[model samples]
Target: MTERDELVPRRRRDRRGRGMRGPAVQPLAATGHRPPLPRSRREVFDKIMLDVVTDIDARWSEHLGLVEYAVEDAPQLPDDWDSGRVPLSSLVRGSGTTPTRLVVFRRPLEHRAADRADLEAIVLALVVEQVAELLGIEPHDVDPRYPSDLDDD
Candidate 1:
């Protein structure tokens, strides 16, 4: 073997190399080719939520009795940002004004999940829960077909 090859450890140089690994795995709903990696768990969650919020707005616009509704990122509160800041994914109550809004915090949701699949499940569940609360009904009532035993069936 070459002198250089002997100097460098075998583990450091493989088909996978130092950083690159196997092919990227794309989320099922992803439209385009897979990215090298998701920008971050939070970014992926945010993208997913954007699509979800759009669908919800379209589906519930009429039921809401208003032409316009808002879905936005929650503000990060000042103080020790590490702990004191409120997360970006929370839905906060708005003033009882003309247009209503539903906020979703991204960071907190990302932090809650162990992986991408878990993140997606948590996001879906959270959306359903939020919508149910907004409509003043139980989560099951919103969609009677909503799965009961989420783990089994």
Candidate 2:
């Protein structure tokens, strides 16, 4: 071995200086030969949230002024959080120049739901309830599809 080769460590040689090694396990989502999997849970949740917001906004655009919607993977809770229930969403009303901000906690809602349909129902119910609170009106007034209305159908 040359003087430089002898000085360097065996593991740091990078496969005898050929190139970097590939990952030990390939991710199935990236493999080209197989059919692609469905959209990610986050993505699906995002779409559902958008659809619900769009439908509601169309009817309330004049009064709502401006609103911001967001989705977080999970909420950060304190070590000694005393509450037994975790919040599924948060709504911060706007004042003056600030726009209303609504945030949905994806993980908590997904955890409570039994299936895709249940997730949709939960998201719709929470969003409508929050929007109603913001507007100081009944949830059914915000959206006819609110949980109460679902029972009549």
Candidate 3:
């Protein structure tokens, strides 16, 4: 061994003697082909909304075909509105040649829901209300599960 080789420990040196050994690392599992992670909360919410639309469309294909469903991160509140207050969860807009669009605001709905089940109910109710508006029918006519008492006097 050379004088320089003698100064360094055997475990620390490679054949070149210039480089030091690093800690051993195990190979990662073969995860490349594994299934994707579960859907995100927002995606799950959107799916719930879509499912409601699909069910409604099956019953009223002619009416639903002309409408569009959308998701927004949050409702655009008026500047005069209180900061601590949450805005409406959904809105239906359009008329005449324009396509009727039902937009559900995700953050406000999530904030209002107590849990997953509650969120599902809230989304369904919103969809029903909007569809009823589009069809000029009562919300209960669209989805019987929608509470009749929710209508303003």
Report the number of the highest-TM-score candidate: 2
| lDDT-superior candidate, 2 or 3 | 2
Number of clashing pairs, model 1? 5
lDDT (Cα, 0-100) at 57 in candidate 1: 60
List the global CA lDDT of all models: 0.60, 0.85, 0.77
For model 2, how does the per-residue alpha-carbon lDDT over 37-112 read when each residue is reduced to its tens digit? Answer: 6899999999999999899888987877899989999988999999999988888889999999999999999999
Clashing pairs in 2: none
Please list the residue runs of candidate 1 whose C-alpha ends up more than 4 Å from where it truly belongs after superposition.
1-38, 66-97, 143-153
lDDT tens digits, residue span 1-153, model 3: 899899986674367765543333222353334444679988898888888878987887777657777888988778888778675455546678887677778888888899988998888888887788778898899888887788663
Global local distance difference test of model 2: 0.85
Q: Identify the leading candidate in terms of lDDT.
A: 2
- Using all chains and alpha carbons, the TM-scores for the candidates as numbered come to 0.52, 0.71, 0.66
Q: Write the per-residue lDDT of candidate 1 for residues 1-153, one digit (tens) a residue.
A: 999998997675446555644346445455455566548655676677776667666776666544233334446576656775455444444456645555666666667779887766676666766677677766665554345665232
